[model samples]
Target: MDRRALPDDDTVATALALALRAPSRGNSQPWRWQITPNSMHLYLDRSRSRPVIAGEERDVLLGCGAVLHHLSVAFAALGWATIVHRMPNPDDDDHLAAVTAVPRRPTNQDIAMSAAITRRRSDRRLYSDWTAPPGYLGLLTERAAALGAMIRLLRDRSGGSRAFEPRPTTQGWAADSAFGSPGPYDLENAAAYWTTSTHSEHAPAGSAAADEIAEPDHADLLLLATPNDDRLAHLRAGEAMSAVLLTATNIGLATCPLSAPLDSADQRLRLRHDALDDTAHPQVILRVGQAPDATDLPPLTPRRSLAEILSPVHA
Candidate 1:
C-alpha cells in the first residue's frame, strides 16, 4: 500500500463515521473533523461542550481523544495507519488532534478492535455476578499502558475488588460548582446521572442502583490514569480508554465508562489519595464484568449524521 495514496471520498467518510461513534459525555458528540487528501483534523466543537460537567474542558478533550483513537482504528482496518499529532496547533485551541493516514496492511488485531467498535455498548445495567477471568484485567491494563496511560485496579477497604458504587447522597453536587446555571450540557449530564444512579419504579427493567450490586466483591473497577495532567495526557487517556473498551467488547465483557467521580476537584483529589494512593492522576473509571444473560442488551445510542460533523479542509 502506498503511504501517500489518497483514500476516496467515501472511504474518508466511512472512517470518520466510525470515529464519531466514540462515546462522549452525555453523548454530546463534542467534536468536528476536517478531511483532506492526506490528513484528518480533529477539532473540538465548543458549542457542544458541556460547561456544567466539563467546565475545564477536561471531559471535552478526553472525548476528542477517544474520537482520535477511533479514527486511527477505523483507518487501520481499512488498510491505512494513522500517525496522530495531538494538540498540534497552539493558535487553535479547538484543534485537538491531527491524524495523518498512511496506507498499510491491516493487522488482525486492528481488524478485531475495529469490528468491536460497533459491538461495544456502554452498559449501565447491572452486570452478572460472574467475576472477570484472572488475566482479563491485566490485558486491559496492558492495552492502556501501550497508549501512554496507566490502569489501576481499585480495591475495597477490606482489600476486595470493588466496582461501580452509587452516587453518595452527601457528596456535594451543585449546578454551579464549576459552571453556573443549567444549560443543555448540564441537563444532559444530570439526566444521565439520575437515570443510572437511581433505582426507582420508573427505572428501566434491568436497571439497578450502581451500589446495589449483589456481589460488589466480584465487580472489577479499573482507573485510567496518566503520569501528568494536561491536554495531551487527557487525550492519550481517552485513546487508551477506547482501546480498553473495544478490547473488552471483543472479549465478550460488558463495560461502562464512569466520569462523574472525576468531574470535581475535590472528588478527584480524594480518588487520587484513596484509590490511587496519590500516585498518578486518574482520568476515568471503568466498570467491567459479565453482563447478565437473562436481560437483553440495549440498542446502540443514536449518533449525529456525517453531514452535521464533517467538512472539507480549508486552504
Candidate 2:
C-alpha cells in the first residue's frame, strides 16, 4: 500500500476522508481537508466552533490537531511522504496547518496506525479485567512523550479504582464533570453537529449501584499533560493525543479520552501532585483496554461537506 502505486486523485481523496474521521471534542468534526495534486491541506473551520467546553479554542485546535496526525499516518501507509507545517499563521487563527504529501516507503508504524483506523471507536462501556502486556504500556508513554505530552497509565487493581473519580458535590456538579469530560461523546451534541440522523438512540439510566458494580478494567489510563499550559501547548498536545489514540486503535485496543477531571482544578489536583499550573495542564486523559466484545461503533462519523468547510478566501 504505497502512495506512488496509487497516484490516482480518488485514492488520495479517500485516504484523506478516512483521516478526517478522527474523533473530536463534542464530535464537532472541526476539521477540513483540501486535496491538491501535490498536497493535502487540513484546516480548522472556526465557524463551527463549540462555545461552551472549548471556550478558549484550545479544544477546537486540539481536535483538528488530532486529525492532522491521523492524516499523516493514513497517507504514509498509502506510501505518501507526509510533511506537516503546523500553525502556519499567528494572525489567521483558523488556519491550523498544511500537510504536504510525498511518496515514500511506508514504515511498520505507519501500517499499524493506518490499519487501526477501521477498528478505533470511543467505547463508554466498562472494560474486562484484562491487562495490557507490560512493554506495550511503556511504549504508549514514550509515544506521548515524543509529542510534548505525558501519559499517566492507571494501574490495574480490583475495582479498577484508579479510573477517573467524579466529584461528590451536588448532583449537577457531578453530572457536569461526567458529561463534560472529553471521553464521552453524547448523542445530543452529535445530532446538532451533523445535519441529519435517523433517530436518537437511548439507553437505560444507570443507578449509583450499577455504576459502582461496573468497574472499569481498562488496560491503562493515560493523561495527556504538557510542559507549558498555554494555547500553543494545548494544540500540540491535541495533535499528539490523536497519534496515541490512532496508534492504539491500529494495535487492537479500545480507547476513551476523558477531559473532565483535567478541566477541574480540584479533580486535577487530586490526580496530579501539583495543581494546574506551569508544570502540567491536563488536555486529555485516556482510558485504553480490550473491549468486552468487538464494537460495532460506526467506522467513521460524518463530516461537513468539503465545500462548507473550505473557503474561497483560502483558495
Candidate 3:
C-alpha cells in the first residue's frame, strides 16, 4: 500500500501568507500563524500589542481578530474549511484562535471576501459629501449584528451630534489621547506609516495639516457599538468592523475608522446620552462615503519579526 501524503509546507505557507494580509491597526501586522496538519493556530504577537491605548488587552485582541477574519475567508478560498476557537485557553499568554481544518467547498461570499482582503485599506480621506444608500446601512448593521454587536449611525444633525463616543479611563490622559497625537498611537509598527506621512514634503501643519493631508471633513460617518464593554466584546467588534469594511470595499465605497470622536470623554458622555440605551460602550466610529480620490497616510511602521513575536514552547 502506498503511504498517504501530508499537506506540503509550501501549500501551508501560501495559504497563511494570503491570510496574513489582513489590515491591522496601522499595518503593524501583529499576528502569527502556526500551521499543523489538523489545524492552524492564530497567535497574538506580544510585540505588536498596544496596552496603553487598548487598555486591558482589548485592542490587541481586536487586532488579532482581524487576522482571524482574514484567515477564515482565505481558508474558504483554498477549499479548506476552518472552525475558529477564540482564546481557547484564558491562561495562555498570546494564543488567539485555533483554526481546525475541514474539507469543504467555497461559496460566492467566501470568494468575494477573499478577493477583497488585499484591496481593502483604511481610507483616511474625506468623502465627496455623498450619502450612503439606504440599504447599505442595513447591510452593515446586519453584519455587526451577526457578531452580536450593533451599528448605529451618528448622523451630523442640525444641532451637532455626538453618538459614537469613547471614554478614556486610563491614567495620564484626558480622553481621546489617541486622537490627540495626529497619528496611529499605540500601533506597534506604525513608524513607517507615521514617519513617512509626517516627513512628506507635501504634508501640512498642525491639526489642519493632518486633515489637509488626509482630506478630512467630508465622509459620512457611522458608529459601531456593542453591549457589555469588555475585552472579548471589543474583539468581536473588531471582527464585525473588518467584515463591514470588507463589504464596503467590495462595493467600491471608501471607508475610514474615526475613533477620534469616540475617544473623547465629553463626546462619549454626550453620545451615550443621545445614542445608546444608557448601557452601551462605543467601540469604533467609521466614516463611509463616496470619494473619487481617497487619500491615505503611508503605513511605514516597523513590526516585530515573526521570530521575535513567536516563541515555540510546544513540547
Candidate 4:
C-alpha cells in the first residue's frame, strides 16, 4: 500500500488552519496549539477562556475538544492517521492532548468531514418547517457515541423535538451574560425560546436572550451529554460535538450549538428530569434543521489568526 503521507510542515499548517475554525463561546477560541518535530500539542489557554462562572468552566473545555476533533479530522483528510492521547498529563490540567500524525491514505468519510470544516456555519436565521429522516439523526448519534458522548433528542410528550418557539405552559428565561444582569421578558410568552429556564440567567443574548425579542427557530433541540461532568467528559462532549456537527453539515443540515440555559446545574437538573432519564452530564444543546434560503443564511462568524492561536511547543 502507498504510505507516503506524513504530516510535514505544510500539511500541519493546513490542518491547523482548518482545525482552528471549530466553534467557541463568543468566538473566544480558548485554545493554544504548539507544533513539535513529530507531534502537535493541544493546551487549554485559561487566559483566553471567559467562563461565565469561575467555577463552571465546561464551555471552555468543550471548545477545546471541538478544535481537537477538528484537528484530527483535518489530519485524516490530509492523508495522515491521528494518534491522540487525551489528557496526557494528569498533573497538568492545561495539557489537553498530544497528537501525532502518521502517513496513510484517507477514507471517504475523512475527506467528506474535512471538507465540512469550511462549509459548516452556525446559521441562526428562522428555519422553515422541516423533517429529517430517522437515519439522519441516528447517524449523528453514532458519531457522538464514537467519541464517548450521547445525543438526546429533547422531545415533548408526543415524542417529538421542540423548536425554539414560545410556550405558555413552560416558564421563561431572559438572561444575557454579556449584559451582566438578566433582562426583562414576557413570562407568559417568553422570547428565550430554545435555551433557558427559570434559574438560568447567564446565556448569551443570541442563544437565549436577555429580553422578549430575539431570533425565531423551528429546529430540533438535542442535548449532547457524557457519562460524567468532569473536565475530560466535557472535553469529550466537545469532540463529539464537532463530530456530530460536521456530520450534520456534510448531510445538508444547518446546525447551531447552544450552551446556555443549561449553563447552570440547577437548569441542567431540571432539563434532566424533563428530557433525559440517563445519568449523563449534558454539555451542549444543538439545534439542527434544514438550512434556510441561501440568501437568508447569516454571515459567518469571524475567527482568530493562526499566529494568535498557534506556536512552537515549549520544552
Q: Which candidate number has the best lDDT?
A: 4
Ten residues in sequence with the least summed lDDT for candidate 4: 183-192
**By lDDT: ranked, best first:** 4, 1, 2, 3
lDDT of 3 at 311: 46
Per-prediction TM-score, please?
A: 0.83, 0.78, 0.75, 0.82
Tens-place lDDT digits, model 4, residues 68-96? 99999998998988988999998998999
lDDT (C-alpha, whole model) for all candidates: 0.72, 0.61, 0.60, 0.73
| Candidate with better TM-score, 2 vs 4 | 4
Pairs with steric clashes in candidate 4 = none
Tell me the deviation in Å of residue 292 in model 1: 1.0
lDDT of 2 by residue, 1-39 (tens): 344423577667667666766777677777766655555
> Where is model 2 more than 4 Å wrong at Cα?
1-8, 35-39, 154-168, 171-219, 269-278, 295-300, 305-308, 313-315
Model 1: per-residue Cα lDDT over 1-315, one tens digit each: 645544778888888889888988878889988876667788889988874453587787778888889988998999988888888999988888877766899999999999989888777655556746668878998999999998877632232544333343333334323442211121114433322223232233443333343333233667889988988888898899999999898888877787765666876787777766787788887777777652477578888999899866667
Model 3 C-alpha lDDT per residue in residues 1-315, reported as the tens digit of each score: 623222355655555665565556655566776655566677777676555344556556667776677667777877777777777778985777777766688889888878877776565534465655668878888887887778887744221344432333333232333444334332222311121222234233454335544433444457777886776776677788778878887777776664434444566566666787676777767666676564553343343444443345465
Give the lDDT of residue 307 in candidate 1: 87
Q: Judge candidate 2 against the unseen true structure and give its global Cα lDDT, from 0 to 1.
A: 0.61
Question: What is the number of backbone collisions in each predicted candidate, taken in the order shown?
Answer: 0, 5, 10, 0
